[model samples]
Target: MSIPNEALQKILQEIGQKKAFAEQQLAIVKQQMAVKTRENRMLQLTASEVDSLPGDTNVYEGVGKMFVCTPIPDVQKRIASESEEINADMSNLQKKQDYLEKTYENSKQSLEQVLRGGGS
Candidate 1:
């Protein structure tokens, strides 16, 4: 059975939209991943620097524009916790990126099939 030209056009349009949407979502995910990765790296570096400091050294954590003197151990713990959270966020973003990539590919394939008259 042959599918009507109108139906084919509609299917193509829908698939194209899906492909575009997925592409946009993928870009967003990539940007988020980049941000998280940078944050994680900064945390790692900060942790390293803090570790090199003497145990009695005073550390200050920025709070809105002013720095408040904080204990070394508290600073270390805070850095560790922030690093873990950033890593987890990056992992989740990676998963989302993978899923979006697959979705975009599938949409592209479907669009191709429809264009080639194989979708009927």
Candidate 2:
């Protein structure tokens, strides 16, 4: 049987709206992923710099290095702790990204089905 024109139009409109919303959500998720990755990279760099510090060496070559070497022990410990926190945050964001991806896919499929007039 042929689908009613009004019903088909309504379905198409709804589907289009849903697909657009899902696309917007996916964009937000992408932004979040990028931010998380940048933050994680920064954390790793800080941790590496801290790890290279030699606690026993009081005198250093450069001014910046000398300052860092002053509180070598504390700085190393703080950076290690921050790195752990950033890692945890990264794991959580990864899980969120996976979930958002699945949601986007499912919404797209539903929209396709609706537009095709496969409604029950």
Candidate 3:
């Protein structure tokens, strides 16, 4: 027997909601990647500029919106460590994005089938 109209509608609605959620999550992941990329670039630029500067350089690091005098070596180390972390995070986000896209595609196909009077 065919599914009831109300039940089919409910299923379709739920599928639509899930698809929207997946899209939103995908957007968030893309934005995060952009932000991480920018941060990585900034770190590279800062390191290069620091290298060009004369020795015994004094720099101030922003800590909770306050600049504190810090040694150059420490700042460089921090930048190196954070870049590695961001790289790992980017890889993880890429995997998550791939999974979300696959799920969304499967859901979309099911929704289409249901709309065409086929079982979801």
RMSD of each: 1.5, 4.9, 2.3
Runs with alpha carbons beyond 4 Å of true place in candidate 3:
64-66
By lDDT, the better pick of 1 and 3 is: 1
Candidate 2 lDDT tens digits, 15-90 = 6777677678778767877886787788688667756767575533246545334466666666678777867877
Best by TM-score: 1
Question: Lowest summed-lDDT stretch of 10 residues in model 1?
Answer: 111-120
Q: Across residues 1-109, which tens digit of lDDT does each residue of candidate 3 receive?
A: 6889899989999999988899899999999999989988998998898778776878888889799988888888998998899899999999999999987898899
TM-score of each: 0.94, 0.66, 0.85
Q: Candidate 1's residue-wise lDDT over 1-120, tens digit each?
A: 777888877888899999999999999999998888888889889999999999988888899989999998999889989988998898899899999999999999888777777454
Least well predicted 10-residue stretch by lDDT in candidate 3? 111-120
lDDT of each: 0.89, 0.70, 0.89
Of the pair 1 and 2, which is ahead by lDDT?
Answer: 1
Candidate 2 residue spans exceeding 4 A from truth: 1-3, 56-70, 118-120
TM-score of 2: 0.66
